[model samples]
Target: MIKESTASAFLFHVDGDGVCRTALVWHPRLEEWLPAGGHIEADEGAAEAAVREVREETGFDAELLPGPSLALPAGFPHTAPVAPWWVVEMDACADNHTREPHRHIDHVFVARVHERGADEGAVHEVRWFTEQEASEAEGLAEDSRLQLKALFAMISDGSLTVAA
Candidate 1:
């Protein structure tokens, strides 16, 4: 049996004029707007990775509005039940064999910036998308849209607390 794993995180920021915006990285597979995130490095924590990823993808440094915590949307199916022992291992192994899900269990944070600033020279390209723009993106995940809407609402208000 081989054991391997990956962790990721994303950031939500508000651009100038209080327009809640998020940094969406262009994923090669699921080519669409997605929250800024990536795999957690060997020596980095979830939040740290998310902050670094946001900066690397968007060239804007962000502060984690909240710590490493689970931000499941309402009625998230995670708590349903654990699969059987072998099934869990099989699923993990099959998933590993195929491809590592990039957005799996990403540690999410909230941060507000007056602007997106700039884009890092990395291969990753970013866009400041409003909720409507994000929702309109083809193949946009429902969960991601929900999360972005929550962030937009919080940023729209005067506070960017981790209420999402």
Candidate 2:
């Protein structure tokens, strides 16, 4: 099967009540709640795609919280882009037989929503979910649910910061 590159951002924000919440969009084609993300465009890298997807889909300006970078020698002639939290390959259309079978190499990122854009019109209905709410949410993919659980646990342990 052919493989296409994609980027996904798990965008989170801390509510006024000191609760961490993540945004999810209902994917009509997949019939599941998913993060705001899409294919990586030809002109951009995965990190750039992740941020752009979040803005276009959810009308939120997000800053990616990249994983730790390796220390390079001072004379290294390259600059490394922000690293994704995780990467996985999944079937793009597992149940849809009409389309050709393809796989997605998804770069998963964790980001914080800095602020909502002036134009709050999103492509899909956006819903915020607390940890408990997300755990109990129906139509959520198991992989996504596991990621959310880890994110919430990190936040609770002060390992992840959601402050703007």
Candidate 3:
């Protein structure tokens, strides 16, 4: 039996000038809009992959919000451990391209960017949507919808602030 492949992904919600919106990409296979994320590559950690995936999909550099970390002992390499803010267990079936059905154990993260734009790495068109717009958007993935709610909550609580 094949085990679910581990993946890392993140969504960026930027708030500048009283506007709140999230970055989304069009999924050609699914024929719908989805968040910026993808499979984790070999030789990459979850957190690293999350950051890399977002940059590749959305063309914006992302940094995970800092969290409590263990203190390194004496003589340690002095590297801080980065952990994912959330983990989602989801199954992604075969699309138009891939025939085999499989599941992805997704390591999810959220980030803030000064601006939203596309770059050469963008395979599909990237768009930003407000919380209400995203929630009402047609053809959005169910998982993505749920995650958006949480992101808006963070924004409401002021834990995640959009800088000018």
Q: Say which candidate scores most in TM-score.
A: 2
Candidate 1: Cα lDDT at 159: 51
lDDT: which is higher, 1 or 2? 2
Q: lDDT by residue for model 3 over 1-164, one digit each (tens)?
A: 23353544445554546778877788887778887777767788777877777787777777676433456788987576476666767767874334677667777776667656545577667788888988899988877888788878877898766553
User: TM-score of predicted model 1?
Assistant: 0.63
Could you tell me the C-alpha RMSD of candidate 3 in Å?
3.1
User: Candidate 1 on 3-79: residue-level lDDT in tens?
Assistant: 43332334555444645556677765556666666555788665566667767766767655653334578988765
What TM-score, to 2 decimals, does candidate 3 have? 0.80
Q: What TM-score would every model get versus the actual structure?
A: 0.63, 0.91, 0.80
lDDT of 2 by residue, 38-146 (tens): 8898999999999999888888888999865677788999988889988999888753432677889999999997654342967877888899999999998889999
Mark the 10 consecutive residues where model 2 has the least summed lDDT. Answer: 92-101
* Pairs in steric clash, model 1: none
Best by lDDT: 2
lDDT winner, 1 or 3:
3
Clashes (backbone N, CA, C under 3 Å), per candidate, total 0, 0, 0
List clashing residue pairs in candidate 3. Answer: none
